[model samples]
Target: MIHKLLTREQIEKGYIRFLEKNPLALMKVNNRSQQIEIILGKKLSNIQYIETANILVEYAETIGIDSFEYLLLYAVESVEERQKIILLRDELTKHDYSVNKYTGNA
Candidate 1:
């Protein structure tokens, strides 16, 4: 589930927590945010942007950095698209070894 709407200060605090955990993820997060801006042709609302950032950070923590970048790219799409990508991601992660077994030999 997505988070409650966050104030600017709350968002900043959340980012600080993310930074404390993964310093290298900052650049990737910034790049993803910029891509979102380009796709939308304008900046996101504070709440939208903050929620996106939080989602990315949380996913990065669970999924590892490489896969998280791919996830962030999906996040640039519409909400329905993001949800679809997330469901696919969850399924893939659940059957990660099985996926690799098929793809690795192909």
Candidate 2:
């Protein structure tokens, strides 16, 4: 079974990186040139993740039910976490966590 330990973002990034490094394998599995572009997320396409699934099977050390689903979920989760961090950082920069300026009472 693929480790559920990995968060969504890690899987997504790893999967994308895998594609970048292994273009020939991608082309062979996709069966068409048009589909490959879609997988890269360069063009609006739904089949990108699906195509990645094939690579997973070939490269994955192990596989089980809903492997692709899990990977996708982790990827999305990772992205959400990053967005939250950005927003939080912005808020932190705007204000300091300190005692009220007017209230002299500590």
Candidate 3:
């Protein structure tokens, strides 16, 4: 089930993390955020990285998922804060794969 979860910006951070790991996604999540800021002509907090993962987990039960462990796994790999922009390609691609497969469209 789909829950009203993860804002595009947060998902973008996940995409960013995925990119850093894969280095081939070419999906510029940071750029996307920047462009969004430019389009709105306003600045937004950079808390999207930390916030999104938490938000996804908070609402996880509603979505019939255990936790945001899949996403959290990368972000909290070593008990140290990591840059969210680093994994835009790989992890996000996996998430996309999961989505596609879940929908039986893969």
On TM-score, the candidate that comes out on top is 2
Report residue 28 deviation for candidate 3 (angstroms): 3.2
Candidate 3's displacement at residue 63, Å, is 15
lDDT of 2 by residue, 42-95 (tens): 552345555676655555535463444434443444667645644564565444
Q: Mind giving the per-residue lDDT tens digits that candidate 1 earns over 1-106?
A: 1222223454455455554555566655666667777777766454345544665557666766643433434333356655565676667666776777889942
On lDDT, the stronger of 1 and 2 is 1
Could you tell me the lDDT of residue 28 within candidate 1?
58
Model 3, stretches more than 4 Å misplaced?
1-17, 24-26, 44-67, 78-106
In candidate 2, which residue ranges exceed 4 Å CA deviation? 1-3, 29-44, 60-106
Q: Candidate 1: misplaced stretches above 4 Å?
A: 1-8, 44-48, 51-106
What CA root-mean-square deviation does each model show from the true structure? 11.7, 13.9, 13.4
Better of 1 and 3 by lDDT: 1
Choose the strongest candidate by lDDT.
1
lDDT of 3 by residue, 7-98 (tens): 46545655357446644223343455566677776554453343344444554555665554345444344433323422443467678899
